[model samples]
Target: MKHEFDSAFHPADIAFKTLKLAPHAWVPNNSRLPVLIYRRAVDPSTKDLGKTFEALLAGNEWLPQWRDSIFDYHHFHSTAHEALAVISGKAEVIVGGPGGEVVSVAAGDVVLLPAGTGHCLQSTEGRFQVVGAYPEGQQWDIRRDALLKEEIAAMEALPFPRSDPVAGRKGPLLQEWT
Candidate 1:
């Protein structure tokens, strides 16, 4: 799991914003960690955006999980944190929950969500898709409702990733997530 990233492709030019979402309705937002959004993190001109993200994320130890469109339903993962890197098109994403903040994301945008944070797709402009990853050794489970105490505990129990998925060691996540 100690693989180094091929420096041939880099996503070092990132403009990130941090937003802390409070526990809302059925969404048990992370109590201490703020979500990270990186605008234009990737190079839109890259021929294989998905492959580039996979290499970048995997190098940081947030192993790439899937390449697909976001589910258009409010849900959260209690087992692990998630990173979504938009590879194509644009979309309006609900970041926190039903009454949470909404953001417009396009190609090259990346959103990092803490465990227990709610998310779903609101709408898309074109052929929208993302390459997602999670912290090493962490698995994921989809929960439509965060109604159980065990779920909350599971989310709170997870630890922060050692490095930012996109930026690697000196990433903004280290500065902002804590």
Candidate 2:
């Protein structure tokens, strides 16, 4: 029996270029992470969190970062299942669980975390990149400070409403989410 491996197969090199040779650009401040927005180069139809339950369950993986910057949690998938494929770059994927290890996933490495896992990413040296997947019905939960900033900016941009709810206009509703 004979097996064949590509002559140019280097784990580090492979990781660095998996998502290379593709058109990439700087993400603007207003733009959220491409993964959560479904704007990355991958198949958007298949990447929806709600419909692609199997991918979420089976724990699909991919390059999670690129050559420039890491994806921001506020811009990435929120409250959804996820898997990661580390082709290159250096980073961490910390999920919530007992003995949840902060695995050092690098080139030719794979890791899977359960749904609703809080994610924070940072790049080492150059740009860090990885492939990732998530379940649907996900939302970006803004931090308390970030939410306050947005609310304040929004309020400053507009005149106060006639009903002034925040100004002690008690309504019939108790809690919104409930």
Lowest lDDT block of 10, candidate 2: 14-23
After superposition, the stretches of candidate 1 with alpha carbons farther than 4 Å from their true spots are: 1-13
What pairs collide in candidate 1? none
What digit string (tens of lDDT, one per residue) describes model 2 on residues 1-178?
1111221112111111111011112111111111111111122233332223223222322212212233443222223324454434556643221222233444433333322233445335334555553323332232212223554343223321121011112210111101
> lDDT of all predictions, in order shown?
0.85, 0.28
Q: What are the models' TM-scores?
A: 0.91, 0.32
Whole-model alpha-carbon lDDT for candidate 1? 0.85
Against the true structure, whose TM-score is highest? 1
Please give the TM-score that candidate 2 achieves against the real structure. 0.32
